[model samples]
Target: MSDVDQSQLFEFLCRMGDNTLVLGHRVSEWCGHAPVLEEDIALANTALDLIGQTQMWLGLAGEVEDKSRSADDLAMLRDVWDFRNVLLVEQPNGDFGQTMMRQFLFDAWHLAMLKALTGSCDDRIAAIAAKSVKEVQYHVERSGDTVVGLGDGTSESHRRMQKALDLLWPYVGEMFVADAVDEAMAKAGVAPDPATLRDAFDARVEAVLTDATLTIPDGGFAHKGGKTGFQHSEHLGHLLTQMQWLQRAYPGATW
Candidate 1:
């Protein structure tokens, strides 16, 4: 790849990494607040896994970018528009059911994407994907099972789970839409074409929802502009403010 292409690739990877890091932080916020003890453990474990993956990806991105910035700097210093994560990850955790639904959607897509990424020509990304696939697989299973259980549990539970799924459906579109950056990476065999993963992701998620006795919500409105070049939701500003406050308030301060 040319230097320009490599630069784009680095930015892309950093975006991916930052997305995971931010979402992991959000999920970790639920550590002690989960509705049940077992779920608390499960969500916490997933949060750790995501954070670890973020570190690996961000490290690689930093190296590729050839900038002096540390992963922490890249993660904490980027503005909301500068962020490349899908909006789904930044969406508020509405309820226990909503949170699970969000995870279910993201994990299912990420698992397939990561599986394909394992074969990428970019050895660094491939290695990261190889390591992350195991954790992502478990995350999908746990979230999927919960989605099924709650969807079929009772009238109230079913209603909440379905509503959760519906509310999250719009954000799913951003995950599969490929852009120029992705196309360049795809040609260089550095990244998977997200469109290719859509079918498998849909099949897997649909099957899980079917078994859960849940309906696939109509994806009427598509939520775009979180990853590529679109504006983010208001929630992202608040998330970044909280995340960056300590670092900005006291530069170079450490525990």
Candidate 2:
């Protein structure tokens, strides 16, 4: 592979790893705080699953970049602008319904992306996708079910769920906007073009939202730049302060 390909590969891998890393941290915040013990445990497990995947994705990214950085370094050291997560994942977890809505939307796209990547020309990427798809399969199911139950449950629950969807729907666009890196990865068969995954994502989301008796908002306007490391929403910086404080203060202190 050429140097340019390698650089794009690193960018692509960071895109994958950073999504899980940022969302996993956001989910972990719910530990001991979920409305019920069952949900608390479930959220924690989901966070753990995502973080475990992070190690593999970011570890491979480091190797591809031939950098000495480990997954820990990437997760703990990056500033807000240096990170490549989608804006959806970094948005504040507003309510339980909001959190689950974010999870469902992202899981729908994430599962579709991972399934396509299982066939990546890069064996390393294929292996990561194969492993991640299993966990994401369950994630999509759980989140979809939650979305339906909440969106269809009581009038209040339904109202809340719809509000959450409206708040979050704008950020969803960034996930499907293909940039130069996505084009390169798609050209190399390292991953699918972001545009190609949309039909499946839309199908799944439409079915679930229908079952939940919810409506998708009209008109499509997506916020961009998070995955490209160009800009992130204000929320991510606050999250990083809490997440990176220990590492920044201690600066290599280890257990």
Tell me, by lDDT, which candidate is best.
2
What lDDT does each candidate get?
Answer: 0.87, 0.94
**Candidate 1 lDDT, tens digit per residue, 1-255?**
453387789868976797788789889889899998988998899999999999898888888878787778788777887888889999998899999999999999889989999998888889999999999999999999999999989999999998998888999988998988888888888888889999999899989999888898764577988887478889989888887898879877778
Residue-by-residue lDDT tens digits, candidate 2, 1-255? 343488889999999999999999999999989999999998999999999999999999999888798999888988887799999999999999999999999999999999999999888889999999999999999999999999999999999999999999999899999999999888877889999999999999999999999999997999888999888999999999999999989998789
Highest TM-score scorer: 2
**Ten-residue region with minimum lDDT total, candidate 2:** 1-10
Clashing residue pairs for model 2? none
Model 1 clashing residue pairs (backbone): none
